[model samples]
Target: MKLLHTSLAALALAGFAGAALAQDPTEIRIQWYSDGIEGEVMQDLLDRFEEENPDIDVVLDNVAYQVIQEQLPIQLASGRGPDIARVTNLKEQAQHWLDLRPYLSDEQVAYWEENFGNRFDWMREDGSDAIPGFLTQLTMVGGFANATLFEQAGVEMPGDGATWDEWVEAAAQVMESQGTAAAFAIDRSGHRISGPNASFGANYIAEDGSPAPIDDGTMEFVTKLVNWTNEGLQLPDVWVSAAGTTYRSGADDFINAQIPLLYSGSWQVANLSTTIGDAFDWVAIGSPCGPAGCSGLAGGAALVAIEYTEHPEEVARVMDWLASEKIVREFSERTLFLPAHAGIVEEGGLEFQSDDPNVPPALDRFVQASGETLPLADQLPAWRWANAYYGALVTRISQAMAGEITLDQARELMDQDIADVVANANQ
Candidate 1:
């Protein structure tokens, strides 16, 4: 009787332990950063995903953009980071991303290949066919003008085919007439300037797949920008106010009505619409032309699974749910972002969830301008050394803007910096 009782208790304990283990859900963490309202929308969608997949738990770590740009790399190198991340610096860090081909069903993989295949190269290693991620939105670099400021100043906004010089000259007239701080300002980013550089015929990629030396085309725009800042025609605070490669936006200046023109990107659409409501009229003016052509860089943020993740199957489930055609359409609609899903983009007719009259036209303008991107500008997004070039440009150009170096000196430094990056990578 004593032996029977002891055996029965042990069996009960084992049964209880098994039940507890079975009830424990697999938890996966997603490191996310937001430029607009997408974070909130993502959480909501994730909540639904969890309700459906009760065995999996999704933890969203909402972080600053700087963390993604700077810290995430360090974490990834140490084999310690979130299971998934939303990142804009895709190509440079492609090796750390998980290939979902083995885990996802063939039909599902086909869907991803079909819809997001165009940008797979942008996020994957060269000559490697890894399904690392999908772009969340397709961003186009462009310009926006405060139309109310133009109207009040009695200066007509520069129309299509207007040169950068012409736009600056027009904005200068507005600044003078309205007593605004400066004419215009571009975001303090090397990537931001690359489009304008390409418009002047600057090609960063060399024939041997190496970084090209700074050319006359890059200098043309850089010189104009430097001269404009010194002349007080361009808002100096954005580039000169920050040291190193810290990003600063002229969006606030435009939002506060302190500047007439803001040369940023299409990602600002949702942000601008939300913040500048009924205060003034603004319009997307596309990219201002240069000697080569009017051009804007094409880029976007991608949601990628980390190769170091333990819960890859769960991560894939989350990625698939988020990347679904229905979810993609919904996310784009709610966030007012340009869809990266080919089906969503091809099917068209996304009724963006905004009553603002400016929203639709601005988005449409970006869609049209995306077609105008220069060939060189279009290729930069996928180039491995593109970030190296971008970083060097920002660092040296900002120094030039701050009177710490001459334009020629900055160009020399940028070339050397890029050469060092390539050399170190090879070594």
Candidate 2:
């Protein structure tokens, strides 16, 4: 009888332990990076999600953008990383993304297909039909002009159809009148210049998927850029300050009023509004025209599920909640980011949450300019080899800008660099 009683007690204890274990929620970690207010906004939404779904715990791991760019790839390649990551290098690292379709319900899959399906190509391998992820925000590369500087300098801001040359000349006038350090500056990035290159009728994609050789159209703008830098019209510190394709931005120069104009992207809207705040007026000028057309490249960051996640179902649940139409709309409105969801975009009426008068019009201008993108420029966002081309361009062009090589040398070297990337990728 004593032995039987002890056995019963042991069984009860085991049952109790099992029940406690079952009560514990599954934990999933999301590695996140922020450029502005989005991080705070996301955490608020996550808090609500946790309240609604008691069986799952979501941990938001905030890290630097450089971590996402450099370190995350290494982790993913090794089949170890956060369950989910927000990344801008979408195409290059698409292989490591988890396909949520198998885990998600039918209705959920249909909803994602309807809303974010079009952009799946940009973040997935070619010939793939997997639902890897969705873009967090859509970005358009464009220009911003300090309206106050233009006005103070009594230099007329370039009109809607102004060419790049005309805009440069106008900016130079402002620089002279305002006694600014430089006329204008572009972010020292190959991606930053691709839009302008496209505006000059350059197409970097070959008939196949490989990168095309540097063409006359590319040289037309690159030559002008190099010459302008040499002539002291373009800000030297932006391109010349960096070497070997290191990313640098002239945003500070623009915000500090050291330059009358800046070429960047729509992502800077929030940062600009918060930093500049009534210091001076500014306006996004869209992309200035070239001989071919006015064009800007389209790209964005995506929230992707990593393939190696232990809790795929939980990760899918978190993704679905965040990607719902209501959540997407709210996120966009609060963060002042352009929505990538087709349904939300078509529904319209995104009242950007910004007190600054400059914010809305700037966003509106990027939306307008996004439609102006050339066919070739539009193709680049989804192209796997686009980064290779961009990297080569920045490296060689910076060398040329710094007088380490001639423009012809830069052109030749760019072609060779792209060829090497293609060869290595094939192997």
Candidate 3:
């Protein structure tokens, strides 16, 4: 009779514990980064999500972009990273993502397949159909013209179908007239250079999916780049003053109105609008064309569910809520981020909002240019080995630009470095 009473008392305690556990909300942590005010916009939406779903709590960890780029793979590899992460190298890290298909209801799964199925290539392994995540911004690399500088210098802005040669000439005239230190300022990033490389007809990836950064087409871009730097047309301080994959932004020069032509991207729209209010008429222009075609790079970061999340269901819940058309539409506009949704993009473009009136037209130029990018440019960003390929390019090209190595030597090293990475990945 004493043992039976003890067993009954234990059972009673267990029942109470289970009831208390049921009332506890699941907490899902997000590893987030923001190029602009997107973090604030997302926080507002996340608060709304929590209000509706009382059993879930969302925590956003806004870390440095460098942390996401360098340290995230280490954390994710140890299976100790955040439940969700917003990342730029989507295909490079697709293996660590949690496929949300099984967690979704059959109807919801069907809807996802219908809407975002195609993009899963960037979120999957090889040909696997994994709905790992969706892009938060459809970003591209191009140039922004400080029109006030052009007008002040009495230099005509290069129009559509103008080649880089034409733009270079116009920029020279502007610099001579305005007495600016640099005629053209490019962000010290290989990603920024890759657009112009593609425009010159360089196929960044081989047919068999190998890295091939240097080709006849890319040589054209590299030659011009070196010439422009030496001739003082392109700022040497940003690219030549640094070496070994260092990032030096020319955004400051553009923001300071010291640069007439700044090679940046659509991602700068919101941040520049907020920071450069009424400073000048900044306009995003189409990428200057080349012999092959007018090419531009389209890429962005995605919010992905990590494979090691303890709260998979709750993570899916948050992602589903965030990926909804209405919410996505709102996020895009409020943050000035380009949406990746097909239907929404086709609904006459995003209703982009901004305090600065020039932002909308600048955004339109970027959007239109993105639409005109060559097929190869669109495909390269989703390549599984893009980060490796780009990293090698950055290192080698920066070395060349810094005069630590000749262009020929840099090209040779780039090819070798990328090949080694591909071989290791294959192994």
Candidate 4:
């Protein structure tokens, strides 16, 4: 009877241990944000991920961009941040990212290298081979035009080789004829501004990879922009109303059909397709030109693993699934985001689902439009000080546009700002 009781107790303990093991899933928390319908689409994919791997559960924390930019660094430094985060400041935050090499199997890492080697390299430490993340959207900034507005107003839309001046003139005619509030609107973003200026040949970063915000090429865009605000061609509230790095989105203005043209990008495709369905005839066009060439800025956000996470293996599992070609293709197609996957891009090109001819064509062109802009590759993008470089350029440039400072003065201040941030970082 004593032996029987001891055996029964041992069996009960084994049962309990098995149950505990079954319950202990590796939980991955993704700090996420959205410009449009990406959040919903991502959640669906994540649910599928959890379904396949019952031992893994993903928690999506849909937070504001401010939280990621402001609070995440502190949390990462304190080892309290989420397991994964979708971030735009990859260069800035590369220091706190997990290498993801050890956790990923040899074949798996090879898959990543094949699909996203260039982008993964973007997240690595300078001169070190490391892959910390993959791109969510390989964003190439461009413009959206209200063809319906132009048609109704009897204004002819400019085709390829149209300069920024010509586009604005066309937009002004449409705005005047249709009684729209503004000729053109753009999201008040440094990235947004930088895109058009690239056509003007502005290397906001100098040849030697130092902060050099303004040159004759850049001044051409800034000068025209300044004059446009004065002439009522460009609206003030979106760009000049805000000070510093504060983003004021002009999405509403463009979507509501108030602005004749919007200087936006591919990320807006899903939103425009779903929200503005049959309401307006709009199209994406080739980016405008200046003396240099017609080109746009290419950039995007990344899904990165936090280095301090306790579950690096689980993180790798989640990343592996997310970064897979099958999953990435679905994500990009569903969300209408441009993919950075080379094979997926090369094989069939992004199988994007959209009716508007402009959307698909623009995606293809944007993907092919690499090397169209001055590559930020050499030192600016590879360095940790990129955020500071961008921040200074954006803020001071905003001030200059608002007429608070001269462009030359803004350039000087930008130089100082970059120096201060770098100096402080070194200390």
lDDT winner between candidates 2 and 4? 2
The sequence of per-residue lDDT tens digits that candidate 1 reaches over residues 1-427 is 9999999999999999989878979999999999999999999999999999988999999999999989999999999899999999999899999999888999999999999999999999999999998999999999999999999999998898999999999999999999999999999999999999999989999998889998999989999999999899889899988877788999999999999999999999999999999999999999999999999999999999999999999899999999999999999999999999999989999999999999999999999899999999989999989988888988888888889999989999999999998999999
Candidate 2 C-alpha lDDT tens digits along 164-183 = 99999999999999899989
What TM-score does candidate 2 reach?
A: 0.96
Candidate 4 CA-lDDT value = 0.81
Candidate 4 off by > 4 Å: 1-17, 354-358, 376-385
Best by TM-score: 2
* Residue-by-residue lDDT tens digits, candidate 3, 1-427: 9999999999999999989877878899999988889999999999999999988989999998999988999998887799999998788788899999989999878867766676778767888888898888888888888899999988889898889889888988999998888888888877787778888988877777777657988878987888788888988878878767777888888888777888888898898899889988878886888887766788888899999999889899999889888988999899888788877887866677776888888878888888778777878777877767677777877677667789899888888888898889789
RMSD of each: 2.8, 2.7, 3.8, 2.6
Candidate order (lDDT): 1, 2, 3, 4
Instruction: Report backbone clashes per prediction.
Output: 0, 0, 0, 0
Candidate 4 lDDT, tens digit per residue, 1-427?
9999999999999999999887978888999989888899999999999999999999999998898888998998887899999988787678899999889889988988888887765687777678798999888777889889999999999987799999999999999999988899877776676666767877766566556645666667877887787688887878788888887877788889989898877777778777788888888875787777877777788999999898999999999999988999999988889888888878866677777665676666566555466554223345566677567766876687688998788767877888898678779
Q: Which runs of model 2 end up more than 4 angstroms from their true locations?
A: 1-22
Write the candidate numbers in order of decreasing TM-score. 2, 1, 3, 4
Better of 3 and 4 by lDDT: 3
User: What are the models' TM-scores?
Assistant: 0.95, 0.96, 0.93, 0.92
TM-score of 4: 0.92
Better of 1 and 3 by lDDT: 1
